[model samples]
Target: MAKDNDPRLLRGAAVRQRILDEAAQYIASQSSIGKLVSISIGEVAEVAVYVRNQARVAHQLKLPFDQEFWGSDVTQEECKARLQEMNDDPSILGVILQRPVPDHINLRSLQSAIHPLKDVEGMNPASIGNIIYNDVALAPCTAAAAVELIRETGLNMEGLEVVMVGHSEIVGKPVAMMLMAEGATVTVCHHMTRSVAMHSRRADVVVVAVGKAHLLGPDMIKPGAVVIDIGINQTPDGILGDVDTEAVKEVAGWITPVPGGVGPVTVAILMRNATIAHQRQIASGWLT
Candidate 1:
């Protein structure tokens, strides 16, 4: 990884800013009935920051910006109420749900309550189907961002062996499907996988998403392989990822850093999804 800022990051930021600007224009031109409504700011401050940044990014791109952010408390009734508000508002272009809600809160209830069009995060079934079928639709932001980061590597994924070290529906499974869709051979391993290093060492590309910190060491990776670490583990020292970054960096030709790597891009991709959702809402003209 380059210690200095990458010029490519600037280019990506410019491209995404343009998309947000153009998307706002499209939304503004729609009839008045399509005014955007309720944007829920979940407990995840990271997500809230992303949403606010997207709004700011849109303004910087010279687009009309007007959005109301609503934060919902963590409670069964509160979640249901928030969903109701989201569903009731035709102008709400997108909704973001902070992850890891308390045990008392029901995720399924909130997920089901969200209208498919406003499910910008693409956790919704429709979005999943779009991903499965390779349709041009909004997808889970983090997964999409990870795939984009992979593409930026300039590695040819076609026929390459890729190993995804997580099995969650959120990232691992979906990313595996995306890789397979691109004609790459994909393997998914989790806690149950026997000898994960055997799978990882052989892969041309390795994506580690399990929450474990620095589980994969330099010896577990092949020389010149690409490594993508998706886990964000907070320890006393700070944050860590699944791949042993320091050790792997010497062996792997390209590796993404924990904080500045996938995390920032993941938020940027979510902005992309919100823009798409806004455009779709304007096109439907249902709320107007």
Candidate 2:
């Protein structure tokens, strides 16, 4: 297996650090600004990991980051009320509602409650809707990361044949829309697709986000095609991605590894989104 050290991966890390450094300097220059608050319901191990990583990045950036953990019994309305309060708070520049919230909570309702300006996670309908007009500056982190990795290939986006596996609103659908906005020819495959390999093998690029582990083997990919795997599945062997990395690496021109690939870039994009949200708040006269 030929493991490629994608220059884009290193470039993303460099960009992430640069943004944090710039943000730290900006915060130092400003009197009162640059605070990110994340709200979570219940004790989810995955959410804890995400929150910890975000907190670490925030500290490195010299931006104040806080997390609010609510009991599983917290009602949807209660969460919405809290979000509304944060929305009105001028001290808060960005707000993130962690996923896998309690089943009692209506995620969509609470997401909508978050003011679009403070919705740093970009899960709000308004943020996703903005992509329809090609306003992708505030797109979902994971989806944006996938597209960025594809761009790293240095291939012309216009008429690029891309087959995206999975059709979830957060990742699949938005990635497809964003790719289309870039003038790519996108074919999205989901559970009902007759033959995913048939479509995938014909594409110039393939992005897989289905949670199933090692679903895309080398045979499914076109030789020299760029592969971006967005899946993170825990296996007996450890963390795994949707694509079979060892096998696909030998055939694909470039590919993203599970833990080291999209994950870091996604976090970087989140920081970028936070910075952008802060800029939007400034534009709206919410912050001076």
Candidate 3:
């Protein structure tokens, strides 16, 4: 375990607080803002914890929040229809669709159904595409959170070498794109990569989101490299991140611990996105 006062360990409390503070200021300036609606397809113990955290942060920001639970048997068409109604409802600020939805439901299609402006999660195809144009104000929560932490390091983004492990749309892919938008030279590694370590070893910063506990170790990184472990895997011992925190921290210049690192900031990013969605809604004249 990393020592409590270890300077190398990057905890999310400060970053999360900074982001929420900015969000709170923005939200306070708004005259009328709608509630953030989180929709869950079915009861999942794990997802409930995430929803609770998000709700807690929403309350802290003083943003109206609502939760909806739909039956698991609902059809994909019905899900899309309900989302469309939310898009038209001025009282609804943004919509968050929880993951691991029923096997029969089309997740991507449902994401596309959410309007880009209200797609606070940035999972919508249109929202992801907007990153290519250098518009990252509204981006995937985890991806955006990762970028925010990297910035917290105070390193110059332009031309910084970054290696991203994993290629999932919600995290890896968007992160690479978001970094590039920040002027960082990014290389993304996946299962087919000849050797992930070879790339990570040379990177100034390495962001891992492969969802495998302890996949990265001391040997895989260069001395003093910034390590951002985005994975959250369950184990008998407890929750663990992709990087071996205890061992990697010895060699790493900085590393984010699993549960206290990216997870909290992710919830804060969601609230920030809500504020951005509110701004765009007014810009589009959808809300007065």
Candidate 4:
């Protein structure tokens, strides 16, 4: 493992702090910002942890925060109705719908129910689609986090060679689109791709978001390449990222560690998104 102070490791702590500081300043300048409401459908431990992190950050940023834990049996209609209510409530600045809702809930429908101006998490289909037109101010949290880290590398984005090793809607797809919006050429590789490594080895930057642990290794990339590992897999050894960090570190110029890499930046993006949502709300006449 590289030393904690290793320059090769692209730890998210600094990037997270930069964003949080900006968010705090922005929130303080606002006349009357509304609370960010987090909605969790079931009693999942992971969801609990995520909510806690978000709430803690909200408190630090001095942004009002609220959360609701619905019973596992909450119906799809009930979820939509509550989101509709949040949409109408001016006190609610934004809404974050936690994932892995009860099987009975239509997650997509609930996402759509959140008004676009209040969709701080940017999970709504309309929100994600905005990336295609290059309006990334409200991109999904994780996808935006990946793009933020790449920017931290201080590399010029225009025409940068980027290979994205996943195609999932939430993370992979949006990240690719976001990168392309910045003028980087992005090739998305999925299970159907015959040679993911073949595409990655030649790229200036490689982003891996497939859920598989250690799916990317040193041999798959060229020396001095930037590797953004967006996967978080729980293994008997511990939580691991899609890229084999230690091994890949030897070859890649910069690599993001699993737990500390993209995770913190993701949470920070939520707060930043709230501020963006606030600005858009004022512009759209949703708030004064």
Candidate 5:
């Protein structure tokens, strides 16, 4: 419900583009020596969409990108072996495992098989563990995008009161850790929380990533608070976010829209992460 000219939207777009341009420039300067590879165990519509978008961005940046698809019957061992092979390959600067792998495969095991330096998606445990010591360069893309959007508000992160309404490893937990590292007092809530509104009402910033449509409403928000909706739920009407955008925008000082809000920025952050992974390889003398 934010106005079209909202500074957060404008700045997010500008930052995303700038990062993409910078990443593209870096890859070109490197003579496109490394490739960004995404491996999927099966054909998933959502995964395909994500990979296609990534390929498009890589194309614009002139980065080498490839997708590897395996049969649905691929075993966990096979997936891990492939990931290990990619991890050991110095020519592969970044590796990503697409989600929704077969039920039999151990996704975490495969994730762990990826070299921490090449985990561009930041799903590897090592990459996330580094965040505890404030090593944010390898943080997850969506979490990084949320933090970037909050920074766009020009608010002081130090001593900011933030309520993160999700505890998932992918988005909620990492975001809370990142916010806390920035000196924000963060309270993480999940399905077990008795009163979500109680915590959210006192927060200066509310980030919801629970994937439930219209879960956060106007009454749950503080006046002039920065609301970041990280949820993307496909409803009968269309795609909606966790917050009731129209109502929250009226009460909140700033709010991110469902479609145009976090998605684009998240994609850009992935490109930035890929570039960072490549840089780390260079610094470690893996790429000369």
Candidate 6:
């Protein structure tokens, strides 16, 4: 464990603030009737609030978000229609579809309905294709954040053994692809993985996102390895990640805590995507 004022922490905090500030300016100047559409209004509100707060934090250096999007009866088609309608409007710059959609709707169609330029969530096939082909299109926010966390540690990822625990398209799979692209040997394990701790102990980097509480203890991690806990489980303790922070902190060289860790970086990166979307729209003469 290092001091709170570690230079890497400061650098990441600075980058997070800078993006939030730019995003806030874009959100304020651009929030108007033309940009409003009718998708899962509640989900849109939830995600928009997140974007705005991150933007606000960029200016104030700290802001708290306490909204939840649970139990919303928002359909994928409704979300798609809203995004399509907004994208049709030249004034609208970007859009994000909050995930964990119910099983009743086709996620593929909903994701495809989003314009590539406005697909800030980056889950659409085109966005996935961009990541697959290394085309530089929108990458998943959490995936980008996970990579950024590792990069800020000043460790070389080349040929490092990387094990990701979780198989979701949004976080785990994309991150595995990214690590592989960065020259690290990557392995993905999910809820069905047998002996997952064995894998974590052998890897140079262990990323846990299984949404379980305290699945990885201190003994599971390898010494001097970087651990990024991507899980967000709401337990009796409120919010908890898959990794046992107290146990792992003592054994691992680097680790990210749940609430103040990956969550903040995820929101910050989303704001970056929004800012880039806004700038792209402006450059393409869509916002004029």
Candidate 1's displacement at residue 105, Å, is 1.6
Count of backbone clashes, every candidate in sequence: 5, 0, 0, 0, 0, 0
User: lDDT of each structure?
Assistant: 0.71, 0.85, 0.93, 0.93, 0.88, 0.70
Q: Against the true structure, what is each candidate's TM-score?
A: 0.80, 0.93, 0.98, 0.99, 0.96, 0.78
- The digit string of per-residue lDDT tens for model 5 on 1-288 reads 456875433235666787788877877887656889988788789999999999999888887899899999988887788888888888788987889988888888888888889999999999999888889888899999999989888899999999999999989989999999999999999999999999999999999999999999999999989999999999998999998998887788888888887788898999899989888888988788
Give the distance in Å from residue 54's predicted Cα in candidate 2 to where it truly belongs: 0.4
Candidate 4, residues 1-288: lDDT per residue as tens digits? 668999999999999999999999999998878999999998999999999999999999999999999999888988888889999999999999998898888889899899888999888899988989899878899999999999999999999999999999999999999999999999999999999989999999999999999999999998999999999999998999999999999999999998899999999999999999999999998888
- The order of the candidates by lDDT, greatest first, is 4, 3, 5, 2, 1, 6
Rank the models by TM-score, top first. 4, 3, 5, 2, 1, 6
Candidate 6 weakest ten by summed lDDT = 32-41
- TM-score head-to-head 2 vs 3, winner: 3
Q: What residue runs in model 3 are displaced by over 4 Å at the alpha carbon?
A: none
Q: Model 6 — TM-score against the truth?
A: 0.78
Worst 10 residues of 4 by lDDT: 73-82
Best by lDDT: 4
Per-residue lDDT tens digits for candidate 1, residues 1-288, read: 445563322123433444456555654665542323324434556655655765665455443345544344557776668677766676555666656555666776677677878786778766777777976368776777677777777889899899999999889988888888888899999999998999999998888899999998999888988888888898986898787787788788677778666776665566567667766765787443
lDDT of 3 by residue, 1-288 (tens): 778799998888999999999999998988878999999997788889888889988998899989999999899889989999999999999999998898999999999999999999999999999998889878999999999888888989999999999999899999999999999999999989999999999999999999889999999999998999899999998999999999999999889998899888998999999999998998999988
Off by over 4 Å in 4: none
lDDT of 4: 0.93
Q: Is candidate 3 or candidate 6 better by TM-score?
A: 3
Query: Model 6, range 231-267, lDDT digits (tens) per residue?
Result: 8898988888788887787788788877667777776
